[model samples]
Target: MGYLFGPVLSRRLGLSMGVDLLKYKTCNLDCVYCELGRTACLTSCRDRFVPRQKVIREIELRRAEPFDHLTFAGSGEPTLSLDLGEIVSRAKELVNSPVAVITNSTLLSSPSVRKEVSAADVVLPSLDAVSEKAFQSINRPASGLLAADMIEGLKEFRKEYSGEIWLEVMLVKGINDEEAEEIARAAESTEPDRIQLNTVVRTPAEPVEPLSEEEMRRMLEIFPGAELIPDWDWCVPDRIRDRLMELLMARPGTLEEISCHLKIDGSDAIKYCKIMENDGLISRRLHGGKLYFHAIDES
Candidate 1:
């Protein structure tokens, strides 16, 4: 699994098989909460960091569970790989699973990058800050980038791109937190399908404080369609749709929590949840501003 790692369970994409196109930490921004330590190769220039052929070959050789997605999400911004579009296209052609790319919105400013990444079925791009001050404090993006410009690019991406865009907002205490209103406004401007509210729960690169769960819940005011990614449980099993229903039978939980609990692929999890929801095996309710699904007979 040199280039491809895990049909790793994800809180978002579930049983996501990852593709690492660039060397570790080769990115344009040094986000304050990056789990992979610091950006070892911080440059904006794009090249064949790992030969596209190698990545494609690895994915072709991969043997695992029915992955929910073939993800281009490994160390650093995946869009920085020059052949990202080709890889995305080839992955789609090679596998039946939906392809996804998790990227920071910095490179979405480029039409070429957006065009390439648009090939994915889902694109999760980060928009952690709106104003320059907060952007610098949180993401510590490359020297030449601007937050305002990045927002514009994200809006533009929504225009031409047809895939589901799950915009990620990495909230940190005091930095982006103080400016939630502004960040929410920026998130609204992008018009993403889902606005994923995440925080620094994992060990951070910097000694930054994470936002309390209550603080994150308050974010619902501005982001009406937002959902919080919970502390997901790790368990991977086959027959994901059935497994998800079985888990819900024990206790009601949010969609992402189900993904985390079962280590199910996010795409496949959502698909199964929908089927279950529609078939009346499960039902949903709003509790504490979070959507919870439960067995229909549960009290």
Candidate 2:
């Protein structure tokens, strides 16, 4: 399961198996609350960062196993992988499971990028801010990316893509939280299938706080088709669950990596892993002072 990670339960998508298309921490935005840590390659350029054939082969292998969805997500943004469309097409050929792409929506302005995601059953893109100041404060995108351009890209993608487009809005307290009206206006202009309201529930790159439930509900009200995803019990397949526990026991991973690999959300992944640790199935360790997990009895 080098490239394939989980069929873990997701709050948004059902049991999902993830495909990592890029190496770790390579992204266009240096979001303030990124759980995966600081962005190493802070650029918006698209390229074939990972070998396409290798990623395809991994997806093919994972498809042989039982899973609900085959998702394109990884340490970095999936759209940054230039051959993403090819990978999606190849994946569809190998499995009947629905294919999805989780992206930051930075590159959706490009016709080719939109076309790439057009084949997927679902495309979840992030729009943390509608204004330039809010964008910088919330997403902290690369130097050249403008909020206007990103919004236009989302608009263009909505017109071209027929799949279920879920607009992800990660709200950070005091920053983008107060701009729900602006975000709602922007989302209305895009006309997406759904608006997933999310907030930071784990350690962030910067010292940011999450919005209150009341604020979240108010924001959701502002956006017509929005839903607030709360942390809860997720359903993972028996075999996949066992394997996930085994993997976590071997090496601790950030919630983002686990979610990307497991095709689940970071918050949900943390909840499940915490339960496992509490039951003594695994133990937590600190490497370089960052928390990780490993199996108590690997034998």
lDDT of 2 at 120: 94
Residues 1-299, model 2: lDDT tens digits: 37777756566775578888777888999899899888988877788777788888787665666556798987889888888899898998999889999999888878888898888989999999988999998888888888888899999998887889888889899888878889889987999998888888778989998887777777767877788875432344576568777677557765556678777666566666656666677665545533455667756
Looking at model 1, how many pairs of residues clash? 5
Local distance difference test values of all predictions, in order: 0.83, 0.79
Best by TM-score: 1
Q: Residues 94-151, candidate 1, lDDT per residue (tens digit)?
A: 9888899999989888999989999999999999998899989988888899999899
What is the model-wide C-alpha lDDT for candidate 2? Answer: 0.79
Candidate 2 Cα RMSD (Å)? 8.5
Q: Model 1, residue 189: displacement in angstroms?
A: 0.9
**Top-scoring candidate (lDDT):** 1
Error of 1 at 16 (Å): 0.3
| Prediction 1 TM-score vs. true | 0.79
TM-score of 2: 0.77
Which residue pairs show collisions in model 1?
A: 13-266, 14-265, 14-266, 15-265, 235-262
